[model samples]
Target chain A: MKTASPFLELEAAPARATVWFDGEPLDLPQGANLAAALLAAGVAVFRHTPASGAPRGPFCLMGACFDCLVEIDGVVRQACMLEVEDGLRVTRPHEAEDSGAPV
Target chain B: MRQCDVIVVGAGPAGMAAAATAADAGLQVALLDEQPRAGGQIYRDVDRVAALRGGILGKDYTEGRALTAAIRRDGIEHLDGAVVWAIEDGFCVSYTRAGQAAQVSAPKVILATGALERPMPLPGWTLPGVMTAGAGQILLKQSGLLARRAVLVGTGPLLYLIAAQMVRAGTPPVALVETQTRADLMRANRHLGGALRGWPYLAKGLAMLAELMRARVPRYTGATTIAIAGDGRAEAVTFRSGGKPRTVACDTVFLHHGVVPNTQAARSVGVPHRWDAAQHCFNPVVDAWGGTAVAGVFLAGDGAGIGGAKVAETAGRIAALKVAEELGRLSADERDRRAAPLNRLRSRQTAIRPFLDAAYPPFAEALAPADATLVCRCEEVTAGEIRGYAKLGCIGPNQTKAFGRAGMGPCQGRYCGLTVTALLAEATGQTPDQTGYYRIRPPLKPVTLGELAAMDDGARDAAE
Candidate 1:
């Protein structure tokens, strides 16, 4: 279920790929920028800060700022740096450790 | 370990041009870039996106195709999707690709790492939907994504350019809240002669503004006390414009003051840097031909200073020529003959820098945010905490890492270093140079332990 996203995709992708964000599967444009695809899919909050647990998203999409960090395949990396590869599993960094605890 | 005569880090205009030029001089050139394709942030993903979105992003961006194409020639080894983490002594460059570590050694290294958007910290800037205007442009260029009701804040030519791009994309911004006052433009007029010499840039900026005007994008100039307002995400922006408080409700806020040199790669390798007061950031000290104090290490493009793409490309060509001369591939006479025109081009390209710097100085509040505002997003360190550290005798950014973990995050002080120095300088009554910046070390980008252990040290030693 796609939420109402403020971001709009200017062009439609010829192919689609499914990637699991947290636990929800998002069918996104294949080969598109991962952070952008997720944003277009309405996944606003990319990760929560480790210190204050405050919600954070992609601030600088060019790899300088690490605010768009997400845990992928157990290694946390910048989501803005990655591409939308099919079957990729991404989770909020430290989400497993938080275990649904309030941020 | 792989060996090359020259290793060019970054695939931006400078790196691509350097690699191409060095290769043309018969030197083995290896180009490494963080992105999956050639084209650094300015021409990011140009190989794929230029054909589709060239009409929207403009000709200046599409022009990057020539440099990107140049890197694909013979004698140039291009490694895309490579994250450079360390540049050890003896010109050894270590990077990771595809979750695997690798090392390459070169007699000469050219750092064309380019610039990053200067952090514009404001109240509620840490909200989820608040992002840099550069980030928004990246979304547009890389994936054709556009935020429906985004408000652009802060001051710079880039703000106007992005607003115009959005207008062209048929989803014009709700408004542009600029921070530059009329006084700033008047102050910048002193450099009008140089700006006129560089008329093309000024003309392009005016054209963008005119496009925005035609699209009816509401613009608020001389905006001050700017702040994002929201709960979990950015819902609106509040600022003082025309001596009146104005609130613009929007789903997203894109903030940009200006860009600064990304000096981590250069500084990490023990390169000497000085605080550029005009640009308000630290820049690696380099000669006209991009020769640094560190031997065998050449710095070019915006990584050395905040020259834009054209200047960077010219600098890249000039540095490559100098490198060829240093390696005895080209004689001094030939190098000078080749570099003289590029030097002239570079000077012409940089003529507008002073005007732009004066016209779009970084937001004053962002330089020293309100006490409650967070300066360090990674550690949740507030400006008040940084000030407290200064009161407690913390004289520099290096010390703040120990006191409040301000620069200890994964970013390694890229975002907060300037702000931290500014806060300490204000509190301690010292210049930014006296206040000092973070002591940058290796592993510039985050590298996993497993990836580190998987390195082929035996091959490296054998090559050594």
Candidate 2:
């Protein structure tokens, strides 16, 4: 899962605190968009489609496309729309399919 | 509860300019935007990120700093991160900010909600690594991020601009898969005289193309049969170039064709709209100053039509001046005198729009995607399913949505509305105007029940 980032960490930019995703703490840049922070940390798989079970990620990061929906603090929101905050907990929202047997 | 002389719907180029102008004329203005900052998609975070990101976002984008500064200096009440859910009669706007409910009312309302990328639902577009070129730019603009290896797809100036931006950011896309045919460019040559008036835009596009060429990115033009294929994430894009099937291996596929006016807010308020035959979308019918048939309601910027940022800025100013005149803050003659230069500049700015519209139309085949291709990514409805609904006498997008639930998603039909409209038109053999758009309801974006219950009914009642 090694993805080289093209974003340069400019010295003038403010330093951000680390956030946790799936129990792993990631040191992401302060004030960067949450989606970019996750991607910068090599976590691109944001969520899976409810119907098709296909992996889906950010598209039209300006809130037009809802593909970047991720669960944060018990709610799902577009990751690109929310800014990265210190100590924020984020997790990929999963919708389980019916196994065809009665629960 | 807050009452203002005018409430501007968006804080983008149009809304910012509108608020500034009205406030300058002694009107109390309330500007609302869903984003944490002003500057709509075109200038998202321009006040902060543009200067920090340096030359990657381009000069036009950074120019939003001026608008942001002007609005702040004008002492206008700016409500950032406000999700306006409902607009009642008499211009009462119900919105939520930071999980708190608030209502703002005014006699006049200006809708500058802006434009969105035209939908292109191709096979495998729902894959993880696939996205729009505008989305890719958002990553760069908002977070300074880029894909490792991307293959840009489709056509239009935004595609080239994003490619150039990527090159500047030191991560040029692996290739460009263009759907526009050589014949299309030849067809656009007819309007070259008008297009030449805006030489700077054309020259900027050319410079971007040259940059892509210099970067040695393989550009496949006139591509037919463009498709993205992957197991779980995007692996490669297959497109036909020069009548030969070609596949480019890439991790990301960014798609774009053109933009269309976002008329949801206007359409929701029952504002009149007409289909623009050239742009192939609904244009809100407005006067010279963005005033709609609905008295107090105005439509400005790309929400009225796709005239780019400069045109949106001018349209916003004109709309504000009109508001000032209506409020008796300025005489009609004075308003017109102030607006004349902006009107002239807007005309010159938009002179080349017809040419661009004709040149980079949305992919016709995308209107009728393969039977299996997903039209509604949220609901997993396919084009074939929508066509089936159309064949069954579903005359409009709303009816199709009722039958199959294509647009009943979290996005509220932002991505699929135009595609559904076009698909229904192609299937039903009716014009897009007859096909119509989705019927947007109140609580437009999802709002919490608590936020709704907490609203001050007194404010809304007073305005009504």
Candidate 3:
């Protein structure tokens, strides 16, 4: 059986969208959900914990579960639920590192 | 890992009721839910409720508010917006919230993840802008993105409930298509009367019907959807009732039969399930208490059945009582005493269940929409691919995966799993429940290599 791909590999295409995560450049779909485009671009776990210091990732891709939640345009929201608007700047929530707010 | 005496998944009715009762008994309790807010689908957003004071919330809604307020107390730790990936041993769980994946462990686990829409495959169901009724409702509720004109299809109280909500939300429904025949509703009344006499739900249903008539929301019963018409998303849906074909011009269509339990957390921890002959879904058979075959892991709420919010609250109390007894927080006598109210509610609610099971079993025999009917919109697989897989002797989802890459997608097999499994089972002459989901792994979501390596080593050490 083909190993169930937990994530898809990003192919380098000329016509690509540049996604910056924590000041890093990544290729993304021109119009993908903030999370799906990120995942397709080889981005992984999108959040972290303040208490136990564990990593977090999306579970329910739909907006139902906030597991895929991230900070897009200065708002905490479900990354999987948000459609990727062109030039949308999304970052890990303030809870990840720095000030240390656990989601 | 952070430890608690009890960790209840889904802070809806079941989780809320369970946490409140258990915490009252002095056991450390943590209530977890996926919504950015605490209330599950039934209660929806509390702020939404708080905003519209004179809305659909009857006396029943008040209890939800009370439960949420109760969850706010010190003893009960509420984590809203946490999506559970799987359940590990001793009720250890992995979840993601705030774009981060984290782990929590508890000695006692109560899963109340609640219900999700069960796809009833039909022609044109996969058309763009064509969505499940529940999906449409979520889109409308969460983001206020709704079709100004639409059609509602399928049966049970939900079709009515969602229609009424849409009407209230100022997005009126154009057509209501119910698969259940008028005769079925009449027959259901025999049980409905008994159930209604005890609860205010009947009145609520009547109000919805009145609203439908007043709004002149064109309603049709015994309607069968033949196909959908559109280039990309749904432009209109074709249906027939009483041998007359009618095409409703719709920008959006909400298709639904009802909901089924989300068994990922339950099945992952090895909870045994049986083909629920009535609901036509797989439900873990449990004792009167929420105790499952798996120790310390109890199943409750709509995850068990389509029991409404009240029954879920009662079931939660029953499960919490069971948990309390095991945790030495309650005496055996107290546990027995707590079971009485729940038993009464169960007896009242279950009177209508068997009728429901028979009337609405996802109409499995009629699942194939049409060969031209799209099944996997994302992958562009159709009824043709299903038949091709069948001819290839792909007996199960795993085997089908070995052949055609059916379930490998962004959805993690949610949208296509049921249809693929059902089609395979039908072709192979096997029971649908036997065709369970593909093996699930975590991130559950994907993260960047940077996200993975950027983990703080000290914090990671603390978790382990």
* Per-model B-chain TM-score: 0.98, 0.97, 0.90
True contacts kept of each: 0.94, 0.68, 0.00
Tens digits of lDDT, candidate 3, B1-464? 67899999988888899899889888898888876677776666555544443253345544567778878787788887676766778667766655666677789999997877775667656443455676554444333334567788777777887787667656678888767776776766666556554455566667888988887888877877556676544668787887899988876677777778876667667788776656766777787898988889998898877787777888988999999899998899988987887798678866656556545446432465566554553344666787788888777776766676665644555556667777777787888777665665554444444444444454379658
Which digits, one per residue and each the tens of the lDDT, describe model 2 over residues B14-76? Answer: 999999999999999999999999989889888778767758877878888999988986559
Better of 1 and 2 by TM-score: 1
Candidate 2's C-alpha runs over 4 A off are A1-14, A94-103, B453-464
DockQ of each: 0.86, 0.53, 0.04
Q: Which candidate order results from sorting by lDDT in descending order?
A: 1, 2, 3
Best by lDDT: 1
lDDT assessment of candidate 1: 0.91
lDDT tens digits, residue span B106-154, model 1: 9999999999889888999989889998899899999988999999999
Query: Which candidate has the highest TM-score of all?
Result: 1
What candidate 1 gets wrong by more than 4 Å, as runs, is A97-103, B457-464
